[model samples]
Target: MKILAPVSSLSEALPLIESGARELYCGLSPAAWGKEHGDNIWLNRRGPGKANLADLEELEDIVTLAHRKETRVFLTMNQPGYVKAFYPDLVSFVRDTLSIGVDALIMADPGLIKRVKEKEPAAVIHVSSLAAVLNSSSIAFFRSLGAQRIIFPRYLDLRVLRKMIEASEGDLEFEAFVLNDGCVFEEGFCHVSHAFGGAFCHNPAWSYKLREISSGGNKVSQVPAGGESFQQNVDEYKRWLWLGIKNFGGFPGPGGYPLGMCGLCALPELQALGIVSLKIVGREASLRKKAAGVKLVRKTLDLLEAGCSESELRERAGELKGVPGLCRSGYMCYYR
Candidate 1:
C-alpha cells in the first residue's frame, strides 16, 4: 500500500517526505480558506486568470524533494465548469507540469481530460473522486479517455464498490480515500461557490453582520460582497440554520483535527487488495498534524509490508489511534 499525505505548508512537507508519504497534495501558498490560491479561483470561474494555478517552482521543489525519497506526486485540477473558460491555461499548466515530469494528475473535469489528451498526451491522469464513477458505464468512459486510475468517491458502500469494480470492463487502476474528512458537498461539482460570485471568488471572505432593512424586516444582513467577506441575508441564512439538517453542523466552529489511526488501519486491507495508493485527506491539515498522520501511516505500512498478520495489524492500528472529532459514528470498519 502507498500512503499519500496532505501538505498544507512547506514547513510540514519535509518531514512527511522523510516519513514515507508516496504523494503529497497542497496549494501553492499557505492559504487556509483556499481563496489566495489560484486553483480556487478557477473553481469559482473557469476563465483566464484561473490559469495562475500556483507557483510552479514551489511545485518543482516538492517534486524534486519527494523524488529524492522515491515518492510520487499528484497535482489536483478538480474544477467543475465550462471547458472553454479555462481550457487554454489548463493546457499550459499540464504542458509545463509534464515537462517537469511529475507523477500523475488528479482531475475531475471532463474538459481537462480532453485537453490533457490533446496537449500532454503521455501524462497520467487519476480520476478525482468528484467524478464519482459509480457505474461501469462511467468507469468505461474514463478508461476510454486514457485515465490511468480512478479515485472512487467515499459515499459508496463496500458491496456496491466491489460490484462496480467487478462489472467494469477496463484495466484502469483504482484509488480510494482511506482516511480524513469529506464534505457532504462533492468536490469539483457543487455550485455553492457560484452563488457568491458569477464566475470566480478569489479569497472571498464571508462576514456575519446584523442589520435592519427598510421594509421593517427585523434582522437583515449586508449585501453579499466578493473578495473574502460573504454576508448572508440575515433572515435567509438564519432560516437555513433552523432547518433540521446535519449539513450545517459545523457552520462556524473550528473544524476537526487529523485522525491518527484512520490511515494506518486501512493499510493491511489495501495491501491485501493490491491497491495502487493509500490517500490520507490532508487538504485542510496543518503541517505538524500532517507530519504526525504521515508518520503513523508510514509506520503502519512498513509493518504490514513485512508480512504482519491481521492480529498484529489490529494491535498496531490501536496503538496509533487518531484524534477524534466532536462527533463520530463510533468504531467501525473503515470501508463499511
Candidate 2:
C-alpha cells in the first residue's frame, strides 16, 4: 500500500515525499475565486486560505517537484456539490490544473465529475470520501462516471469495505483513512457549512440532553438535567471529541506523533483487502504535525511489511502513538 500525505504549500512537498509519502493531495483556491465569490463561499470542502494553495503557480511548482521524485500529486475539488452557476468556473479551474500536470482530480459531485470527464477525457479522477460511497452499487455508479479510484468514507466497517471490494467488478482502486480527523457524521449528508468558521459538530458550546418518552406520551428526563451522572457522560463525550479533533488536547503525544482516530492496526487487513493507498487526513495542520504523521505511518507500514503479526503490529502501533490508554479505550480507533 502507498502512503498518501496531505500537502498544502510548496514547502511541504519535498519533506513529505522524503518522509515516505508516495502520493500527495492538496486543495487549491485561486485568488479570483475569493474575489468573485467572497471568502464565505468555499471552492473546496476545507477553509480557503490556510487549507488551500492560493495560486496555480505554487501548485505547478509542487507538482514539478513531486514528479521528479516519482510522487503523484492530486488536487481536491471535492465539495459535496456546487451550485449550477459555479460549474462554468469550476470546469475552467479544473482544466487549468490538469494542464499544469496535476496527476488527478479528487472530487465528489457526480455532475461535476461527468462534466470534467466530458471535457478532459484522459483526466484521472478519484471519488472523494465526501461522495460517501457505501456499497458495491455506489462503486459501480462512480465507475460508470469514470472515477478510477474511491477514497472510502471514514467510519465504515472494515467487513463492509472488504465485502464491497470483493463484490465489485473491474480494477477500481480503493483508499482508506489510516490516520487523523474523524467526523461525527457522514460528510455527504451533512448540510452545515464549514465555510464560515467551522463545522457545527465542533461547536464547544453545544450541549446534549438524554430524554425518554413517558407512557403519557410526553417527554421525561432519563437523568435530571445537569445531574452528576448526566454531566459526567456529556463531559466524557466532549473529551473523546477533543481527542479526535486535536489529538490529545491540541499537542503531539510523547512519541511526537498526533494521536487521533487511527487504523494502524488494520493495515494488514486493509492491504489484504486490496486497499491501494493509506490516507493521513490533515491538510491544514502545521508542518511538524504533518511530517510526524507521515513518519509514524511509515514506521508502522515498515513493521507490517517486515512480516509482523497482527497482534504484534497493534502493540507496536500503540507504543509508537504513546497513548496505550487511548488505544485500549478504543475511542481513537478507526477499525475497532
Root-mean-square deviation of Cα positions for candidate 2 versus the true structure, in angstroms: 2.7
Error of 1 at 301 (Å): 2.5
Runs in model 2 lying further than 4 Å from the true structure: 203-206, 212-235
TM-score of 2: 0.93
CA lDDT for candidate 1: 0.59
Number of clashes recorded per candidate: 11, 0
Worst ten-residue run, lDDT, model 2?
196-205
Please provide TM-scores, in order, for all candidate models, with all chains considered together.
0.68, 0.93
| Residues 1-336, model 2: lDDT tens digits | 999999999999999999999999999988788899887677789867688998999999999999999999999988888887889888899889999999999999999999989988999999999999999999999999999999999988999998999988898999999999888788888877775556666744478876677868876758765647977888877877877755665588898998889999999999999999999998888888899999999999999999999999999999999997788788898888
Can you write out model 1's per-residue Cα lDDT over 1-336, one digit (the tens) per residue? 677776644455578888678777654322321443354455322222222224667678778877887877777776554458667766766777777767888788777797788777889988887786777788889888889998887645556666777777657787777665543344445565533322232222334555547656554655554643433344443333222112123122222234311434556655554467777764544555566656666667777878888778766665554322212232223453
lDDT of each: 0.59, 0.90
